[model samples]
Target: MHEVFTSAMLAASVAAAPAQLSSIDELAGTWTLVAADLIKTDGSVVRDYGNAPKGLLVIDSGGRYSLQIFKAERVHFASADKGAGTDAEFRSAVLGSSTHCGQMRLDGGQLHFHIEGASFPNWEGTVQKRNFEFTGEQLRYLVPARSDGTVPVSVWRRLAGQAARP
Candidate 1:
């Protein structure tokens, strides 16, 4: 489900906006997940996504954003019903997917995500701060280390349109 920021909400946020991101106007478009990696504190890497990860991140002019990421290859549950998945299926679904939507603020080198909702209940109503960098068409960020002592870094590339371009 996509939640949109109405005109009033957008006006209110812009009224007190201290962190202006005019420099990152190039990021006002749809971006597709290009790469994702989790680095453990032990200096090991977990690559459960094989070679491809599927996801989308959309950023609008109002600072509202939505992100969804998932493993490209997930096993199907035995039951076709959405709520009747087996334990293993449920586990896989939870472990291999993430979804969050809310407003975001970019201040200098720091990025803040004011999460309105998330697939991980613990993250709902929380603010996540991260260091971010944008190079060419790719936007990258280093998330704060997780409770498991792993840091997940994600890269997103702008999705080009079919028409016009060199």
Candidate 2:
């Protein structure tokens, strides 16, 4: 009787343990930037995505993320090895283009990102975090200001059937 009771108790405990956090595998795929809203310090709204500026975000199953931003009449520089110019000149001439590689993980319902790259030199040692809320077809991510500044919000729509394979 004692042996049976112990076995049952252990089984119940195992079953009661909370499920592991969902991996980035669930979010892996190419995601197009649909729209963005920026809240200014004075509480004004800015709809700047529909202009010349555009953005793209790609998340891989291996917890890597890449982001690209493009704008009209922007002269961006490439690495000298790519035949653009010297490394120093390339870095100085790069105006608004940015490429960042980062690790991402999902905890509960929040998505966390750790950024790394020379593209955004200021963000080299920083970890940018965001909270994600999902609806039927849209996922809204809210990013709070690191300091006491205004916050930025992004809304992404999933491409049909592009979720990572199980």
Local accuracy of candidate 1 as per-residue lDDT tens digits, 113-142: 899999999999999986665654666666
Q: Distance from true position, residue 21, model 2, in Å?
A: 8.2
Across 88-157, the per-residue lDDT of candidate 2 in tens digits comes to 6555446545456788777655677788764768877577766665443444565665275655556566
Error of 2 at 125 (Å): 3.3
Clashes of 1: 0
Candidate 1 residue-wise lDDT at 48: 34
lDDT of 1 at 11: 31
Question: What stretches of model 1 exceed 4 Å from their correct place?
Answer: 1-25, 162-166
Candidate 2 backbone collisions, by pair: none
Best lDDT among the predictions, by candidate number: 1
RMSD of each candidate relative to the true structure: 10.8, 15.1
